[model samples]
Target chain A: MNSPLITRFIFLFVFLSLINAQDKNGYFSLENRLKFGNFLFCKGDYIRAIDEYNFVLTKQNNDTLKFKIALAYQKLERYDESENSFKELFTSQQFGSEAKFEYFKTLYLSDKFETMHKRIADDSFIESSISDKLKRLYNLKHLYSSKSIEDSSKFFQPFNQNESIELLKFYVRKQNLDNKSPALAAVLSAIIPGLGKVYTENYGDGITAFLLTGVLTFLAIDNFNADHNFRGWLFTTLAAYFYAGNIYGSAASAVLFNANVRMNFDSDLTLFLNKNNHFSSNSNLFCK
Target chain B: MKKYIYILILFFCSVSFSNDELARQYEYADKLFNDQNYFEAITEFKRLSFFDEKNVYAYESNYKIGIAYKYGGFYDNSVFYLSHAIRTTENIDERIQAEFQIVRCNILRKTTDRALQLLSQMEKDSVYSNHQNEIHYWKGWSYMISDRWDSAAESFANISDDHELKILSEQVSNDKYSVTFARVISYILPGAGQFYTGNYLSGLMSLAWNVLWGYLTINSFIENRAFDGVAIGSLLWLRFYRGNIQNAEKLAVQKNIEIANTALLYLMENYRGEKP
Candidate 1:
């Protein structure tokens, strides 16, 4: 057989090799950890799944693995972490169109619509992979949320003519420009008690404000002539203030009412669009 | 394989054991607190504190127990637990809150002397001096309850620059004067005092009615209409003069009440000051 010293050396070498292999096997292997994370994610134990996925990320160096980490964070409602991961993947270029799409989705979900719009505006290549319908929706949302109505209208021009009309109407109403028209009406009515309200489409209130103020003023004047100076002055002052305040208040009320009407219209339009569109759309789509 | 399986089972079991126990206790306590079953929540927290003496939540539990007692109107019990929380807790916020509650408990128990002493100490402390306005407000109330009107007025006047409390203090002080003014004005020119004190229309009406009756009585007497003069003078003129004086007093009183109400409304709706 072999010499005793050589035999002992060989045994020791094998034992050391076995120990090294066991050490390499890891406390929890990357693959096993990922599997555990996925299992937890599927079972809706998102918090634990995120922990496992994070553990895998420390040992693993793969884009797909990173994507899974982001998905896990998303599942856990750790939106800030998920958005950062998606943003990293989007910039890497290796992750391709799917990564870009997911990045946009994460940004949208996090209410980072402005950044999503900038990405779409800067990268022409993003449009080729994402559907035309999706692009339209994203653009619409971006426009709707944008402060500039003119810019929003320009973005919405390609979708529907009716949408343009509706948007302009909304813009006017939101800006409270409806008050200008009602103010004119109120001024006209002030010239004659119920006339301004008729012009403003509030015949009832205008008539009431006018009649009450007119009667009070007449009574006050009559009382003054009859030598009831105190009573006369009291009613006269009350009438004057009420009449002036009514004119100013009516204009303001009309503007507020129009703003409410415009808000309602936009809501109805959004609901209609959502019902007709089959692809799941986001509320931000109206922003564009 | 069997060995690995056994290791995994042990790990899972250990995790479940600690996590499940902690979560169950947390949820049970939360539910009890939410349901306003504060008494039961205190017991659970006590159990938790017993199990884990170093747990920070034990301080919270003690504080909450004091709060529950305070809300239940058990001022003595509130003071005891709140004092315990203040002495035992390391958290500055919790300690400050507990100290405040202890002071509040003393006030509720009508131990104003102790409450005032504690408030004075707090006023001296740089950390709690910012709460002096509230302290003075309560002190004023305590003084009022003790029938120390002048002291109450002084305390109220100290913070009268505070929009709401100033008005309240003014009303309390004004009530004393309103009663005096109404009686004094009635003793003066029948209704001239009422007019000077802001009852214009009523004062003029009183004066006019009284003078007319007086004039008619005098005119009849001068015309040698003795029977008519006596009847008018004794009945109409005398009755009107007395009626004018009474009206003046009533109007003055009413005006004072209106002023108090106006000040009260200002305190309730517009004053930015601290309230009881």
Candidate 2:
């Protein structure tokens, strides 16, 4: 009787424990989950952080919490999702300007600069109410999207006198940096052997192109003069092909060189403006 | 007597309470994982591991995290945490499981050398002796992924005589053209290599081009038009001949890759074998 009773007691204990185990919320309360989610967010695991935030968001009406979800998305380079999240606070008045700015940032970071470029110039959107400093900064951003900083006037128009002069000087230095012209390169090579490559500063290739063409042309002429007509014509054809190829290659090199220049200038300008904060308050969102 | 009974009941209740919590958390994490919420499951599993002071769920949670990372395509992280899991557990089976997972990670990340190294090391060890066939199976997968069809077939041949992978790999190897042969033959005969490689149209075009240019040069020379003869011979004929050789070499390599990929794709989709 005693043996049977002890076994029954043990079964009852395990049964009660199993029941508690079946309950979903037996271990971690909702509050503890929120804490763990925040911990994950700080740990740079944005995807998991999103899960936690999404979990807590089910019963919450927190805008800041929502903004964090968007920020986390931005950090993860999921710009599309980030942009959508920022858009939710667009009508909140306090956060609208910041939201719009972040929205633009998402666009910029995603290399959709064309749309951001167009939107900045378009007047139908809410571009007026954002601060004057911010307006100028955005206008400058708009200008940088498509064209190189050819004329500093449009970009400097948004800054104070001192910063305007500083920006002007920066761009003036930028515009003076050596840049190649593909058209001019081709024209030069066409007019004179290897001249276009030399114009593009490819001295070694230019010299090689010159020597190869010169030797082949010389060989062709000598063969023709000596009545070795077949060899002469062969060298002539080769010389002509090389000359034309050199012209085409020089033009392509110049195009690549100019693109590199543009890329460098863009990065330099972005860094300079960011280092100086561009005289605007982009640190805090418009949500305030 | 009543006081002793109360103490016994109180002690049992606390022990069961904690046990219940562990079981609940593990099931919740499992549910999340089964639902395909990998990242969420990772967090839950990680939490369980962190709180399991008795080491009850520590090994399990860490392994789950590794699998989660693998499922998420974070192969490097998978390797990192799986290696950690390897050190945490003393279970021979789980350690081997983690080791295989690491091999999969390396292969998927295109580090075939690392995958092969690991597999070869495991082959030399007595620990994985029981799972030798399984080891060779994954080694074959690694070879198949890298398009080393011959080696893949060799790997599968050890598993069984008529293994499907072995047959598939054999077919891929046989179907592939030797790039060197194509190059050498093209060197000897203009466009002949392309013809041998089943590129009939290109071969015919190349042959016609070479023949036409050859005729032009020869006719010019016979007529004492030396200039025209040399011009046509070097400019058009030589260029076409060189281009034909280049195309033959390139086409042979491309065809081989295409054959390998076809077999790899079929096996990946239709095979009934144990897959990584």
**Which candidate comes out best when scored by DockQ?**
2
Which lDDT tens digits does candidate 1 get at residues B178-248? Answer: 54565566556556756756778877877787787678668757856554455456655778777877776
Q: What would the per-residue lDDT of candidate 1 be over residues A199-233, giving only the tens digit for each residue?
A: 66777887777776776687577657767575467
Off by over 4 Å in 2: A1-28, A80-173, A203-248, A263-288, B1-9, B32-55, B68-74, B212-235
TM-score for candidate 2, please give it.
0.74
RMSD of each candidate?
17.1, 6.7
lDDT of 1 at A216: 66
Candidate 1: chain B TM-score equals 0.53
Which predicted model would earn the best lDDT? 2
Tens digit of per-residue lDDT, candidate 2, span A76-148: 9998899899889777566676777667666765767667767677665456665454456565564455445
Off by over 4 Å in 1: A1-52, A61-83, A91-95, A105-117, A131-134, A142-186, A193-200, A269-288, B1-276
lDDT values, one for every candidate: 0.62, 0.78
Worst ten-residue run, lDDT, model 1 chain A? A278-287
